[model samples]
Structures are given as C-alpha cells and as structure tokens.
Target: MTLTLHLDAAGWREHLQSVRNDVPGLVPVAKGNGYGFGLARLAAETSALGVDTLAVGTSLEVDQVRAGGWDGDIVVLTPWSRHDPVATALLGDPQVITTVSRVDDLTTILELNPQARLLAELLTSMKRHGLGRADLPALRSLAPVARFEGWTIHLPMRSPDPLAEARELATAAQAAVEAPVWLSHLPLDDYATLRSELNVEARLRMGTALWLGAPKTRRTTARVLDLHPVRRGERVGYWQRRASRDGWVVVVSGGTANGVALSAPTSAASLKQRAVALATGALDASGHALSPYTIAGRKRSFVEPPHMQSSLVFLPGAAGVAIGDEVPVELRLTTATVDQVVDE
Candidate 1:
C-alpha cells in the first residue's frame, strides 16, 4: 500500500519555466517539506533553473541543498541567531547569505564573522520578523564591516496595496544602504512596478507560486489495502463505533503519519466560511469526519481517526471500489508526506 504523488513532468516543467520567465531575478524558495516536493528534489530543480541563489527556511537545510546538487548561494529565510549552532557554524561560508533582522543580531554576527555576507530584513506589515524602520539607519554603520548583499521585506500575502508598502520599505532600505532589494509575497505586476520604480535592483523570493503554482500538473493517490463489508449498527474500527449504514470499511494508505486528517488552522474570513468551519468541527467532534479519500468519484467518511500508515474510510453501498485499487486523495500538498513521487 502506498500514498503516491504523480506528476505530469512535461506540464510541471513548462509551468516552472513560465514562472521563471514572468518573474525576473526569481530566487526560488525550497523550504518546509519543499512545498510537498521534498527539499532535495527542490534543490535539484533549483540547480536546473540555474538561478544564482536558493532560499531555504533554516541553516539546517543547507547541507540537504548541497547534497541535492545545488552548488550556488543559499540564503536562510530565518533570521540569524547567535544561539543556533547551525547558523553560527555557517558564518564562515561565503556562499551562504544569512538574514539579519535585529541590530543586535547583526552586531553579534559581525563580532563572530567580520565579513559575513548579510541580507538585512526591514519590518514589514507581516511583523513576524525583521528590524524596525527606526533601526534602518543602524545598518549603515555595520554595512562597511560586512557585505550587505540586499535588503529584504516580507510583505503579507493578502494586502490591499503591496506595491505601495514594498516601494516605501524598499525606498527606506535603499536610503540606509545601497544594495539590491529582495521581496516576498508581492504581486507580479507590483514587483515589476517596484523594480522599475526603485533605484537599486529588486528580486522576488517565491515559494508556493513557484513550485506548486499549477495544480493541474500534479495528482495524489492512495492504494486501497483492504475492504470489509459492513451492515447497519455493526461495530467497526478501533473504537468499535456502530456503523450507521451498510457500507464497506475500506482501509487505504495514508494516515496521521503522512499528514492525513491533519489540518492547519483555518483562515475563515467570512461569516459563511466560519459557520461552515464550525459545522465541520461539530461533525468531527461527533466522529463523523469526512475523509480525504475519494472512492468511485465520491468522498467517503472516515471510519475513525487515521492510524499511523493507513486510514479506514466508510464507503457507502452506492459506490463500487475494490481492494488494490488506487483512489484519489485530496489533501493540502504542503502538509502531506507521500511514499513515492512518480513522473507520468
């Protein structure tokens, strides 16, 4: 039994090239399960793209990128910390560009490596990390001692006017230090506009939009391991809950270990969406949760919470599916850990 991701290799490559063409100076981001393709695979793809730089989430990923055949510059998205041994150890590597957010971190980094290459991140609307706008001028003093490759601003994914904010921050950053501007989450048109409007260079660091942009190019499937006929009120699963209707208890590959039935916090913005979320939660609380597996073109309900390597799906009598069949699975790609990836 296997949970597999199938790829339309030709279509995926075409989409990747299209994004690269649209976004000039694109720094492809390969981090955090590598957007479901895995970090090593993404690093290899990044090498194929021939970009000068690749951005990973942490210094710990640098070795994986190197092992995957990426021999270019690597920029760690997480800000440098004096306490992180991996980050500190990478200080001497000229090809690794460390992101410095706080003024004190910059001081600490410089104290350790006098000529460490750095990317200064200014505080954006996201406010997750970065040095405050008031601290921008402080980078000027440290610029001489260290190599300031660029200034970065991580804008929010949903913004009314990302271009305006990016332009403002990029302007401020350029004023403080004469270096290229690196941006995240800015729209394509806005990035182009900002790049043209700004004095120094501007580069877009893209993750989801770069790798998983074309949904049609990939498919996920799980193999049916076993099936058992069930009648109404029949006990099933580990909880031995009574079956509500006549159906087949279908065991399929993919479970909690592979991120099946695991959900990220919902970003329910509207009242209707929030109400739907609440109703879904109510159903889950009642042990009537919908499974991601689709059998005979219909989504099935879970017999119980997923086990480590497989799930029990309640397939009603209306659907016809047998063991050993490959069924489609709808899941958030970023969270899924599949057994294999096949090029179709």
Candidate 2:
C-alpha cells in the first residue's frame, strides 16, 4: 500500500523555469515538507535551476539542502536567536545567511562570529518577527561589523494593499541601510513594479506559488488495500460507528502519519467560509466527516477517523473500485507526507 504524488516531470520543470524567469532574483524556498515535494527534491531542483541562493524556514534544514547537492548559499528565514544552538552554530558559515530581527541579537551574533553574514528582517504589519523601526537605528550601528547581506520583509497574505506596505517598509529599510530587499507573499507584477519604483536590488522568497501553483502538473493518490461489504447499521472501524447505508468499507493507504485528515488552523476570512467551517465541524462532531479520497469520481465520507497508516472510507453501493485501485486524494501538499513521488 502506498500514498504517492505523481508529477509531470517535463511540465513541472517548464513551470519552475517559467516562474524563475518571470520573477527576477527568485529565491526558491525549500522548507517544511518542501511544499510536499520534499526538501531534498526541492534542493536538487534548486541546483538544476542554477540559482545562487536557497531559502529555508529554519537553520536545521541547511544540512538537508547541502546533502541534496545544493552547493550555493542557504538563507534561514526564521529570525536568529542565541538560544537556538543550530542557528548559533551556523553563524560562522559564510554561505549561510541568518536573519537578525533584533538589534541585541545582532550584537550577540557579531560577538560570536563577527564575520557572520546576516539579513535584516524589518517588522511588517504581520508583526510576526522582525526588527522594529525604532531598532533600525541601533541596527545601522552594528550592521557594518557583520556582513550585512540585505533586508527582508514577510508581507501578510491578506492585506488591502500589500505592495503599498512593502514599498513603505522597503523605503524605511533603505533609509536605515541601503541594501537589497528580499520579500515574500507579493505578486510577480507587484514585485516588478516595486523593484522598478525603488530602483534597488530585490528578491522574492517563494514557496507554494513556485512549487504547487500549477495543480494540473501534479496528482496525489492512495492505493486501496482492502474492501469489505457492509450493510446499513453494521458496526465497523475503531469507533465502531454503524454504517449509514449499504456500502463497502474501503481501506486506503494514508492516514495521520501521512498527513491525511490533518489540517492547519484555518484563516477563514469571509463570513460564508466561517459558516461553512462551522457546519463542517458540526458534521464531524456527529461522525459524518468527509474524507479527502475520491472514489468513482466523487469524494467519499470517512467511515471513521483514520488509522495510523490507512483510512476507512465508505463507498456506497457498487462504485467500480477494487483491492488494488489507486484513488485520487485531495490534500494540502505542504502538509502531506507521501510514500513516493513518481515523476513521469
């Protein structure tokens, strides 16, 4: 039994190259399941793209990139801290650029490795992590001691006018210290406009859009391990919930361990979406949750919660499925951990 991601190799490569060409100074981000293609695969793809730098979410991922044959620079997106031994250990590596969000962290980093290459992350409206505007003055004083690579700002995805905010922040960062600006979550057109308007070097850190933007280029599927005919009201699965209709207990290869039925907190922005989410939660509470698996051209419902390595989905009546059939699965690639990726 297997859960696999099927990739159109030629189409995927073409898409990657197209994105790379469209976005000037594109830094492919390979972190956190590598956007479902895996870190090593993305690292290898980055090498194939011939990009000078690859950005990871944390310092711990540096070794994975290196092991995947990425000989160029690796930039850790997470802010550097003295408490993180992995981040501290990477300070001396010239090829690794650590993001310094706080002024005091910069000083400590400099004391540890004066020649450490650093990226200054300016605080954006996201307010997640970064050096505040007030901290910029202090940053200027200590920036020269370290190899200051550039400035980075992670813009929020849901904003009225992110370009305007990015322009303002980029301007502020330049005012403090004139350096290249690295950004995230900005559209390609907006990034181009910003680069032209600012007249400064800029790079875009891309993850989802770069890898999984073209959904047609990839497909995820799970192999059907077994199927058992069950009548209505027959108890089955771990919870032993009675079947709602005459159907088959279809066990497929994918579960929580493989990121099936697992979801990150939803950032539902609209009233309708929130209402729909509440409805879904209510259904789940009553044991009528929808499964991601698609059988006979329709999404099925889970008979019960998924097991460690398999899921039992209810297939009502005869739906033309078999023991070794591969059914399509819809899931977030970033959160999925498939057994194999077959590049056709």
Question: Which residue pairs in candidate 1 have backbone atoms (N, alpha carbon, C) closer than 3 angstroms, thus clashing?
Answer: none
Best model per lDDT: 2
Give all TM-scores, in the order shown: 0.98, 0.98
lDDT of 1 by residue, 21-104 (tens): 788989999988878889999999888877899999999999998999999999999999888999999989989999999999
Candidates in order: C-alpha RMSD to true structure: 1.1, 1.0
Residue 218 displacement in candidate 1 (angstroms): 0.8
Q: What does candidate 2's lDDT look like per residue over 88-116, in tens digits?
A: 99998889999998888888888899989
How many residue pairs clash (N, CA or C atoms closer than 3 angstroms) in each of the candidate models, in the order given? 0, 0
Model 1 alpha-carbon drift over 4 Å, by segment: none
Model 2 ranges off by over 4 Å: none
Point out the worst 10-residue segment of candidate 2 by lDDT: 137-146
Please give the lDDT score at residue 36 for candidate 2.
89
- Cα lDDT, all candidates: 0.90, 0.91
